[model samples]
Target: MVQDSPATRARILAAAVEEFSAHGLAGARIDRIAEAAVANKSSIYVYFGNKEKLFAAAMDRVIGDLSDAVPLTEHDLPNYAGRMFDYVVDHPEALRMSMWRHLERPSAGPVVTELYERKLEAMASEAHPSGLPPMDLLVLVVGLSGAWLTSSRDLLAAEGGDPYSAERLATHRAAMVEAARRVVDGV
Candidate 1:
């Protein structure tokens, strides 16, 4: 329970995020994090215990930042999806960090579970009343966004494909809205 100054703590956390996101727990280096934070290694260890804990904390902060960027709301589904896609594109680092975590089985920790549960609650509140369960709605939301974020590169490389191109994104946005409508309408 060391009460570090906010500025120092924020810098360490930011640096840790970049390090852990770029290199998983096994590959991440405390020296690099310290350098990036402009703080000594001792401070990082004192604040976060160890590299594993720091990685988890960094991930948690990323999740918090994302929640702030896209506060959950009872909005239309397609609009929500569009916002999610836009956020991921804008914050590519966060997306990459998350993907790295998924790749590295850090732990089945409560922080991740709670983050997901919050997402589920928001999705359930916004889901179309097609009798779809909360989990299903959650899956749909995550699945669509995950597909877009993870596959955007490959999708773009496809012939005549350009996922980030204005026209393609717009079309995808429209299709997502229509899909939501159909799901909700039970069509």
Candidate 2:
């Protein structure tokens, strides 16, 4: 059994996220991940097996972290959106990685599907309204994230702007939640 420090694993994961985000699984290079991690390429292969596995693991870690950060309860919608926005602001790489994955349409390996299903289940459980279909809620949540990521620059450029400013973010968060509530409430 090889002993690996948590810090070392974290470094490797961080490096993997960066590399994968910049270049999809197809374009990402193991050498770059090794260089960024300060770990030998052989070590990455030994630990993660291959670039595909490493990319999946890195994405899984990020998704898990994000799920933890954004609770799914209806009461948590605004806060959840805010946290998501905060996450994108802090980890733009994650967003880039996601976009790349969507664009590439890579094979849905176990790790990818499992994490995605978990998120869908969580979203269904949390946003399950009395009359609304679970899929609708799912779409709403996913759409919100998509809109934020896609329109972030435009939002930031608006007059009196500062999309990432705390106050503006809070306002946007509240508005999004209210919009969701209105739809869910059938108002």
Candidate 3:
């Protein structure tokens, strides 16, 4: 029997996240993941069934972590977008993973779908509702939050500045927050 320990599983997950983020689903290799994780290939199979399943599991973890990292709030949504930008700044791999998922994954977990649904339901229940349509707020917030990472090159060139400049990063984050706030505050 292939007894998978929590430690081993975690290592595999960590390695898988890096691998998938770097290479997406098609380019990711089981051997590379196994080597980086220091776990056997059979163990990976036993734990996650296959590379696709491993990818799913890793993405599931990412969404779950994001849910915790940026929980929905009754107060300022701009703050929420700011928080997301801050998070992405620190965890760019999450953004890469999301990009890869969107591009390479034809479908994703119901858990992520349900998470979005829950957010939509929450927005629907807001007392001072933004009046945005279903999932629009969520979509807008995500797009605004990630725009910096996706558009750094263009933004840098347009702004005539270094991408890594602290001022530029702060400015980008502020814009993301303001954009989200506008969307949420809009009808």
Candidate 4:
């Protein structure tokens, strides 16, 4: 058995993210994750107990990374939306893994719950007088931020250019930020 360490654990989680993003929790294979991580299957089981737990851990890790990368700026919702759009554009797999969890798990784990609660609290504490409640505002902002990236291919290809090209991404990011501003500003 390969020795277990923090590095090995991190590798497993990273590989698991890729696997789960591609195949989802139901279709993800432990052997493939272990092989991708250059670790053994026993290490994964020892570290995460089972495939489901591993998926949870992977989700937590990716969400944590996103939070760290783009700490919520509730005070500047538009900038926050733009930053989120940038993050997702750079790391689409993270969003894919999150979508898989939503479909297969359908329950927020502790880390996700805590992070979401924190964001809600922050939004509630903000002095802005948006018409919508904090939870709804947050949802609106998040939805607007990810819309371009998650939209159907037909909609994306409507412009007859690479939807993910730099120019198109900038345009979408600008529109998302403006939408967030309007939603938060109640305009």
Best-performing candidate as measured by lDDT: 4
lDDT of 2 by residue, 1-187 (tens): 4567676677898999888888888898988988999887888877788777788787777666666765555444544555666677677875776677677744422244565567667656664443566556656755675465568676558756666677876677677766655655554
Per-residue lDDT of model 1, residues 19-64, tens digit only: 8777866788999999999888998888889887888888888877
The deviation in Å at residue 31 for candidate 2 is 2.0
Task: Quote each prediction's TM-score.
Answer: 0.75, 0.71, 0.83, 0.88
Error of 1 at 136 (Å): 0.9
Ranking of all candidate structures by their lDDT, best first? 4, 3, 1, 2
Candidate 3 lDDT over 46-107, as tens digits, reads 88999999998888777667768977663567887788888878887778878887898857
Look at candidate 3 and give me any clashing residue pairs.
none
Best by TM-score: 4
Candidate 3 local lDDT, residue 1: 38
Q: Candidate 4 residues 1-187, lDDT tens each?
A: 5565998989998999999889999899999999999998998998999998998888887777888899887778889889988998899877887788788986644355677788788778767678688888887888898888889999878889798889988887887788888888885
Pairs that collide, model 1: none
- lDDT computed for candidate 2: 0.68
Rank list by TM-score: 4, 3, 1, 2
Q: Give the distance in Å from residue 6's predicted Cα in candidate 3 to where it truly belongs.
A: 2.3
Q: Pick out the ten consecutive residues of candidate 3 with the lowest summed lDDT.
A: 106-115
lDDT of each: 0.72, 0.68, 0.79, 0.85
Clashing pairs in 4: none
Error of 1 at 40 (Å): 1.7
